[model samples]
Target: MPSVLKTQPWNVHRLPAAEGKRFLVTGGNAGIGYFVAEQLAGTGATVVLGSRDAAKAEAAIASIRSRVPGAKVQHLRLDLADLASLKTSVDALGPDRLDAVVYNAGVALDHPPRRETKDGHELMFATNHLGHFALTGWLAPLLVATPGSRIITTGSFAAKSERLDFDDLQNTHDYRPKRTYGRSKLAQMLFSFELDRRLRAAGSTTLSVVVHPGGALDSLTPSRPQVRVRTTGERLRGLPLGLLVQGKEAGAWPAVRAVLDPDVRGGHLWGPRVFGLRGRPGLAPIWDHLADTTTAARLWAASCDLTGVAPTFTPV
Candidate 1:
């Protein structure tokens, strides 16, 4: 594995995103999301911070305004755990189109047993994949309407642990929190790749990209109330192993690179250079199986059926 510090650093400061573009970033309150939102705001783009918590989103916006001095930042309530919230947010987002939508919100369930969201999907699957899946589907028109629009989904290196379990998509039969989380992240990457393929096939110009922050101990993985006990146990295990994790800022870089770098190609993966785990941002190779046409087509159909929202705009 390349060390996290050895990779080439991404100079996001050189990005010219301030030229009257609009962006929507989920979980923009703190950690990597905060940094991504802050940097974009600094560039003078109209940034919409998406959060389940209204207060946190507002505070995040305030913090960005303070840093950027006239940074155009706003907040919208979006609870990835609830399909109703997703619908409301999409409806309430109004007709204003977006230049990009960054799916940065995620959760890590370290709790015992397992839980499901209001949508009857596993919590990890619901929040990390389905919610974002539905949101992006709903906003496809807005994204497609804007020229050069991009959709960036936050994935994780942990995804390497497992492949999608189609038989048990919700983990109701066999539930392991970590494995479930990995499956969700893997689904996210697959979704991005599949979406890109669909868009291209339809002749759409929009871009869909996926990125993973090496190993930043950021809020991307929040301890749910039910999972706190497991987290404590894991922390104890880590103490003896002496694992060195990078900060959230380092994790935020890959996603930032995916969003701001004009050279970033659709379906490319980005991560830190060292062992591809930590350091500066660079394009990383994706697993070949992820690009399988059959898999991508099937998943897209499954998403549409599950979400009950067919994509309105075909890529062209």
Candidate 2:
């Protein structure tokens, strides 16, 4: 059966066929990323789970295959926290052309005295923004070569209120875990818009779209056994919150839509419909800070310097 037509409501369960295409979902081992990978797999596309843990990746792949029988899925060892390893990760993606890449992996630090990676960069910022920035630069060539390719970034509602302190991008002088995490995500959203502008100027066919999961909770998500086991108590507790929050599966909607929707274009922000919180994915208004090109340009330059990956997009 063909996936539902493009109309009033976007249906997550009925995605259009994407045969022969390849998509990468970072942190696909669990949470929203897992559901994104699984749903894309059902479209007859090759879904590669970008994860740091081999065991977790295997479990996710198994779970996907079980759900999407004959699903084309595999694992790619990706440690986004390690910027130096991203280029190698891209090279290992093989000769198959990439159709899309969903930047969904993220690290959330609820409380902390602040942490840094081996590369001496803040952990959440490194994993959430810089790593993807570097990875995108590495993958730029492949994306440029593939017709109608897309780069989907997963931002967060938590980032809407945050703004970057260009002088203190890493929150070096003063750091609060949650706020810093939000800032990192804001960076991701800013990058997404800036990348779209660059791609357009270069006349590249690759589209860059940003999305937010919008209040997804594990307790509200469905169980995938090997991937995750939601307790009965958890489900009961989550039932009441469904009006305001959604499951990780539902949270995966916007990114998945951005990847496959023919109507979706670059510089667009997609999220849940109801209060931008819980419901089917739809076009969400871009936060004001996301449109500050000056900040985005500065962030891009800093990212290039930090990762040493300068992306030059030109028609391929």
- Highest TM-score scorer: 2
**Candidate 2 C-alpha RMSD relative to the actual structure:** 3.3
Q: Compose the digit string of candidate 2's lDDT tens values, residues 1-316.
A: 0122243566888999999999999999989999999999999999999999999999999999999989999999999999889889999998779999999999998887889999999999999999999999989989988999999999987787898998899999878998999999999999999999999999999999999988999999999999899999999999999989899999999999999988888898888989999899888777778889999999999999998888878776
lDDT of 1 by residue, 1-316 (tens): 2112243335755656556888899998776887788778877788898998887787777777766888999888889888766777878778886988899998888976788776777888888988888898789888888878899999887888677767777788878889889988888889898888778877888889888887776332333232112265565554532244555656777777777777777787888867776677787877766767676667777877777766655743
Give lDDT for model 2: 0.92
Model 1 TM-score (2 dp): 0.86
- The backbone clash count of each candidate, in order, is 10, 0
My TM-score estimates for the predictions, one after another, are 0.86, 0.97
- Tell me the whole-model lDDT of each prediction, alpha carbons only: 0.77, 0.92
Worst 10 residues of 1 by lDDT: 221-230
The clash tally of candidate 2 reads 0
Query: What is the lDDT, from 0 to 100, of the residue 309 in candidate 2?
Result: 85
